[model samples]
Target: MSEIHGSYDMGPSVLSPENVAPKTAEVQDLERILRGEISAVEAYKQVLEKYSTYENANSLRRILVEHEKAVDFWKKQLRSQESFVEESSGPWGTVVETFVGAAKLFGDGPTLRALKEGEEHGLNEYQDLIENGNVNFESESFIKTICLDQQRLHIATLDSLIMMNKV
Candidate 1:
């Protein structure tokens, strides 16, 4: 099994994948952004591996790069600042895990549709985060921008699913 700390030496911890659902609205917003970062990163990797065309591959790569960078930026912000409350249940985490399971029982189109739906849910969660003062103004702005970018990518993925699967 893979290690949680991004290393092989650490034994795989049985910790439940984090849910970014915060109790407070502000913290909830940050959690949604955090969860998006996680989901986009994973989807980026999956798309990169699953597709072959230069255009499609590069599209996924760009999305992955941006989201990965955002993840790094948020991690840094979390380290430097205070006031954000972390969450235990996040839409991104749950959706991605659910997608993994769905892949087994559903066609690629269905799976992609499910992921797109999850992405939409995640976008809504982030919206709630922003409207609720779940984060500072600057942090909120930054995460909101990232969430928007993820939305565009999610839309693209949805289109790709329809094109590929006739869905």
Candidate 2:
């Protein structure tokens, strides 16, 4: 059997195991980020609906637009790489959403705080990926952009919370 790249079997082979390994790893990392973005979208939507009458409702809505953009970007990246895009937030995100729903019972302030914490968590996750070189070079730019956006959202959420307190 002929070999390519000194590792791939080129005879009667339908798939290259060596090539598939790295690609699968990259896809899995990107999918994790995509899932986080999906969770962010859901969390922001819940906050918007629960606090529709709050003074900063419009601000929260604007932040949701950012999360939506990230979601779209990650989904596109996954599709381009021929990866299966995850549509749900998974178990942990479900628990967080449940807590967010409960937080709404207290007040908009608490809900906003919870969202701020979530954004901070996302920012750290992205930073970890970038710092640890978990993302491939081609995907680094997208990950960095998402990290910056998460930072902005976290700061905005904090600002909104502070402003709400002053009211």
Candidate 3:
């Protein structure tokens, strides 16, 4: 119901130089992961749009929609929390943008493979972030479960696509 800001503003104090100091590598990784989630959703959308006429268009669309849902969930949570920090240098966005451009140039086969690889990288990143003590972010178990599923599904999807000569 409320308008979403990129991050919650508890007060100006939170933005003070000392309070907003650079984050540790682990926290930076969490920020990167969050950015990657958004990027993945964007990449998936680009893929669905690019391959709307492909044989498995509907499946692609389903995956893209699901990813969009996940992106929104994380964005909403990050915006709601006061302590959420934005990265000074956003590597995830660059990575996603490059992948999307590649997807646009290549056909569905290679694009999907690239996406699967990205998802695999994301899975490892999320696992590492979850294990990092500096981040200490607590999300719903459902989110964790969904992240795990995305990782596994990406691997399976890549394997099936390769086997079927779809990608």
Judging by lDDT against the true structure, name the best candidate. Answer: 2
Candidate 1 vs candidate 3, TM-score winner: 3
**Which runs in model 3 stand beyond 4 Å of their true positions?**
1-29, 83-91, 134-137
What candidate 2 gets wrong by more than 4 Å, as runs, is 1-23
Per-model tally of clashing residue pairs: 8, 0, 0
Q: Poorest 10 consecutive residues of model 2 by lDDT?
A: 12-21
lDDT of 2 by residue, 1-167 (tens): 96556565566433333333355666777878888888988988887776678766777777778888888888788777756567787886797799899978887567767787888888887887788776666568876765677666666766667566521
* All candidates: TM-score: 0.61, 0.77, 0.69
Taking every candidate in turn, the Cα RMSD to the unseen true structure, in Å, is: 10.6, 7.0, 8.3
Query: In model 1, which runs have C-alpha deviations exceeding 4 angstroms?
Result: 1-28, 52-55, 82-95, 144-146, 164-167
Worst 10 residues of 3 by lDDT: 80-89
lDDT of 1 by residue, 1-167 (tens): 96577546654343222532235554444555676677767755654455545444555566567767767766555544443433323565666766745563665566556556656766676677667675777787775676666776767776785686633
| Per-residue accuracy of model 3 over 1-167 as CA lDDT, tens digit each | 98877977676654433555465564455456667777777777667666678776676666667666766665555455433644332676677768767766866567777877877887787676667644434553534778778677867876676566562
**Model 1's lDDT to the true fold?**
0.60
| C-alpha lDDT score of every prediction, in listed order | 0.60, 0.74, 0.64
